[model samples]
Target: MPHPTGPRVRLRAGTRLRTTLALVLLAATLTVGAVGVVGVVATTSTAAEAPRTWVVDAVDDTSGNRWDSVDTGTSVVTIRVGDTVEWQFDRATQGHDLVSLAPSQPWETVWPTALQEYRDAGGPSVTYTFDQPGTYRYECSLHGPLMTGTIVVVPADSTNQPPTADPVVEPLTGPAPLVVHATANASDPDGDEVVVAWELGTGGAPTYTDHTMVEYTTPGTYVVRLRVSDSRGGLHVEEFPVTVTGTGGPGTDPPTDGALPAIDALAAPAQGTAPLAVAFSTQVTTRGEVHPYSVGLDDYPSIAGEAVLVRSRGRTHTTLSVTGTKPSARHGSVHVHEQACDDELGGAHFRLDTTQPFAEPNEIWPLFTSDASGASGLVEVTKAVRAGPQAVSVVVHDPDNAARRIGCADLAPGTADLTYSWAFGDGTTATGADPDHTYATPGTYTATVTVAHASGEHAGHATVSDAVTVVVGAAATSTPSPTPVPVVDGTPPRISRVGPVRTVRTSRPVVTARVRDAASVVSKKAIVIRVDGRRATKVRWDRARGIVRWRPAKALAPGRHVVRLVATDAAGNRAARRWRFVVRLR
Candidate 1:
């Protein structure tokens, strides 16, 4: 049904409940005016009071007619005393009457006679002038609680202007448990004293003060609001946003020049055997200020006393002790099990067990952690585990709270703690943990295998057969030649025709070389060219033709340039050649 006074005031669809509570509170604080219908009269004054008109639209829909306006949108409107408000009713609506619900009148009292006339003539609109400075509550008698609004009337005097509030927040972004300083600059035109209150937009009891400091325990974006009210009841508000990063501890310094903390260098032994204990170290550096750093192992507890508090741009080295026991032999085979955890001490675990059920036993290593940057550790390998191909990896959880893999390093075969290379003495060599080779021509050949241990300083060689003789005889008519056996190519690539030892020019000069191997070149990346110890840009390699070409992207600065070329074949054999050339600008 349409409200008699026009349409009922409708709250936004989603906020009906909140709007109702707010209107009830507003009704309790407002003062009701006299409800009798009075004749409109023009008052004479020394200066003409030009009346301002505000429109309260009466809209029609399936439910009924609704009151709408910028002020009606929020269920309240503000106006100076003596300003006029027009309640324009839609002609097609019916049964809606604007009634005063304030203390001075009953809920059923109809307001302004123009509304009554509008019902009869289908054209009359009602206008009301507020003469007193106070809040008045009104509603449509027919629609009851659903149709309601408030009018806040202020003194017309210019001296009653509201205070202006300006808020300032310092060090807006930092690590969690961030401390933020907030202050407001507020002023009232009438020189009235103003009270300032602070509110955290996320929710809490407001703090009353002009300047205050607050701490945010969790990492997120928060809004800090300042409300300033003058003695005359005029109010103003402003808000400032603060961002808290989650990278480090609360005591950590905020970023400057906007750079993040990083792991500079990590050093550790690449391989280890069973019953191995290794010490690893890494340097953590920050572009700006520093904070506390920690190191932890995958399944083990964090090194309790290893936290370092950094305050400047210097690097801090953290050491970790790791030990791995020999794998247990089961069913004539060895099995090693390892696991990684989410945190230093607790959380989910990453397990690696090759002998879980029906699976074959494999070698596994535990991962490690060092803050959010990187981690390092060691795993032991026994002769049984080394007999076959195995998979190994180092895993670290993501620092951004993403419960997934952060960093991983996969270990492959032949990259273990020990390597063996064999020389057949027939100008052919093979390399692997265990390799086999067959001589093409029958003759006495010396076969020797050199074992290179991970401990760089230790290596050993053993003669498998000093002189193995083979005699070739006429083959039977139907007999096929012995199947060829594959052997590892141990010879490195050879480099030839390197030049332009010296050149004077303004343009970049190209360095070219012909590299070859008895077997074959590895790939385009097999050849690397460096100028002045730095990898040269725009390197091109023709693998089929064994041609390597490199040219600097920019013109060479006139000076002595050292060019070095390193080439490797398919079998991991590497050879390097260097040249010094002088370039002078023309």
Candidate 2:
């Protein structure tokens, strides 16, 4: 019997395994014909040449995991439009699905339009063809952002170009139960047939035509995206923001000086009176080591920036213009707060309206993304700055998960001198900027910083706090759970001295490898064999001798062959190795 983690269990030589429940029909139809699988197309051309197929592998859950970088397992490939890319998920222990993230939008994610998703009963291999040329970003829904891959599709023919989409969203802002209409007027330079699709960012199905009507019942900001594709494989994307106010909340609405949602309806709300030329900067550090193990902690560690704001006392608005270099193409949310870089970073959203809910209508959120040179342009949010101690900091948050603050910067203080205190997660406290908290125990910890602006112009009334979770090692088990994988075993098993290398004289070759873990190896048949990327069955494992062997169901072909073996430990840590061997003439 084959293990659940092995590549989709092979049946006979010609037949494949597929399930109706796990298949995704949004992108294309799945009809497993007699020859094989097909679903890719290209732009115009009589002699366009045959469409080539590309193969990409999904990192299995029992393998090295999503934490491993590219060369370890993750794949980033560049291809032409209409080319078919097949993704293999045979050893998918976690049952993963591939979904796209409206690549251009920062604070919004639409349920990926995919071909086939691997459920417990889904097919082992799924294929998708790029009908349009665009940079597509996708990730496994089960694993988070770290388990991600990118596909850059270019035009098959240069003369035939991609189309451009001009997305016009009407009534961009309004009260609760706001109804909005979004349309895309797209054109291709080559006068080719165009297909338009709109993703409403509401987790609902997308509209097929060039125009669609959507209703926004929620209060927060939503980014709607439009994709334009030409028959010749040229594609383009355009994004717009739509803000809907809540029925009622805590604060009042700031002035409409900066009422429009930033570039993509991401996070830009401006309300304030005058200008207070104050400037400050800070580096963007990823504080994402939460207990549950949030993804993308190390993705944007070096992304840094600063902001210049208008600060004053007793005003009902604040203007924040972001001016700095952020080298990352990915974006996060930015907000201005009353406190200067304390726990919660810049304090809560500096809201002038105490009755409105926590949203853009009453708060100041400026959104920005940089180019290749790290230039993030200007972002302004209008509101009354309380001068000195209040409204003096800007913080950037993760676009998908706001709890993760990726970057922060403080404003130039006016007459208020502040002191700082730090509390490391491991029961240790310190004064000033003490960077001496050495990490020994492997666990998840959230460090906090408190700022004090007492004794001067702002007495003891100006104390604030901010915290960013800095995760170390794996997901620690602080609380009790059914399975304690991270809490119990943190190390993966070790495999050494694999055999079946060079040339073998016999038609039946014996493959051998030694796999052992500090803890006991729980996998009864931990060894999985693959020949040239295709999963092979009938391979037997001899645990008594610590070696797995494989011979042909028939006779071996006389030539070079490659074998890939992946072994999983009791704790689910996986190791993989690939070796080549040859069968010669007798």
| Best-performing candidate as measured by lDDT | 2
Instruction: Name the runs in model 1 displaced over 4 angstroms.
Output: 1-37, 45-49, 62-66, 70-75, 91-94, 103-123, 163-229, 233-586
Model 1: colliding residue pairs: 3-95, 3-96, 4-95, 4-96, 4-97, 5-96, 5-97
Best candidate according to TM-score: 2
Tens digit of per-residue lDDT, candidate 2, span 1-586: 1111111212122111110001011222232222255542333422255455556665443222231222212244444545556666544433344555453432232323443243322345656665554565565533332244555455444444456555567776687788888778777666888777787767576777877898877554455656666654455554444556663321122212211111000001111112211111111111110111122236444433334443322322232222222455444455655444543334455444423333454556676675555445434444543322334456665544443555565544422234556675669766642233544555555566665553544556655554434434534448776763555766666555465576754344445455555444636477787886777787666453244546554345778888888888777888788889886533
lDDT of the structure predicted as candidate 2: 0.47
| Alpha carbon lDDT at 176, candidate 2 | 71
Instruction: Write the residue-wise lDDT of candidate 1 on 47-157 in tens digits.
Output: 134546556654444433345553445444555555666665653243345555433321112232322211211334556775545555565432223345555455555
